[model samples]
Target: MAKVFIYPATSLILSDLVARFGHEPLGAALSIRERIQTPGLESPPLQITPEDPKKGLRYAAVEVPSGVRGRMAIYGPLLEQSEAAIIVTDAEMAFGCMGCARTNELILFSLRQRGIPLLELTYPKSEEEGVQFVKAIREFLAGLQEGGS
Candidate 1:
């Protein structure tokens, strides 16, 4: 199964859909879960370690805001592990909001640079659109299963 990165990594809908389609979903939920569950974590709610910023340096410049660096530390590794990705734009905050526009841009740029299989879709505004959106995602994921680009 392909490892599919869902944009707005916090979207449970996307994460569930990806998993339903038989691919591993790489997103913030799983990452944060790992952090919170780590044996020696001092702050489960914070879900961050002192060295996270240093790890983030691999993805962002040292001069960038530390917030961006910290976020990248979590997302960068997911991007590296992704074999495919599904990105939904113009999504509502409830759908998933990364909470940082700069980090979002960096993540998108990095994904594009990777040249992996990517399916970019617009957030559905109506029931019809929602159906089409899910259909597209399913088709894209099925294509991945078939080893087609």
Candidate 2:
């Protein structure tokens, strides 16, 4: 079973990738509850403190620093012991939502430097678009599996 860190992206592409391909995908604090139902590792999801003061204390969206670190900490060892990593991101837009962009960049950079095969994808615009995205992702995975590394 290949391990894929979907990273935090718009929509639910990450989870979709995991569900469709049967790949192990790490989830953030918010997603942890949902992901627990899936048959996989029981590691805790990442949780980051929010940088926005407007959000007040105890404010942590899914894509905060803690979430990123949580994901990295939990998945880092798994990735180190595994064969590859797959990260999904919005190719069209630059991340600018507080610390989310930074976290994403770090995750992307780490995965790239680790020499894991990286596959970047743009966010889907519509239902049909989502189908296409999933198809493309699945095809990529199939190619990798068939090539036998």
Candidate 3:
């Protein structure tokens, strides 16, 4: 199965759709879960270790904001692992909010640079558009399954 990275990384709907279509969804929920469940992560609410920022430096420059670096620490690895990706633009906060414009820009840039099988979709405003949105995603994913990249 292809490892598909969903943009926003926090969109449960996109994550579920990717998995339902028989691909592995690489997103923040799974990554954060690994941090939370891992032993020796002493910071409760922060859910980060000292090494997390260091890990992020691999993807982002040291001059970048620490918050962006921290976020990259989580998303960078997923980007590297992705065999394909689905990016939903203009999404509502309820859908998934990465909460940092700089980080968002960086993530999108990184994904584009990777040259993976990528599907870019706009967030649907109506039920009809929603149907088409999902159809497009399903078709793209199906193409990946058939060795289309």
**Which candidate number would show the highest TM-score if scored against the true structure?**
1
Which residue pairs in model 3 clash with each other?
none
Full ranking by TM-score: 1, 3, 2
Tens digit per residue, CA lDDT, model 3, 87-148 = 99998866776667898999999999988899999999999999999999999888886323
- Expressed as tens digits, the lDDT of each residue in 1-149 for candidate 1 is 99999996888899999999888989877322333444421212465876888889999999998878988888898899898999999988668766678988999999999889999999999999999999999999988953224
> Could you list the CA RMSD of all candidates, in the order they appear?
5.2, 9.6, 5.2
TM-score of predicted structure 2: 0.54
CA shift of 84, model 2, Å: 3.2
Per-residue error (Å), model 1, residue 78: 0.7
TM-score for model 1? 0.86
Q: What is the C-alpha lDDT of each candidate?
A: 0.83, 0.50, 0.82
Runs with alpha carbons beyond 4 Å of true place in candidate 3: 30-46, 146-148
Error of 3 at 148 (Å): 7.0
| Superposition error at 107 for model 1 (Å) | 0.3
Candidate 1: give its CA RMSD in angstroms: 5.2
Query: Which 10 consecutive positions of candidate 1 have the poorest summed lDDT?
Result: 35-44
Runs in model 1 lying further than 4 Å from the true structure: 30-46, 146-149
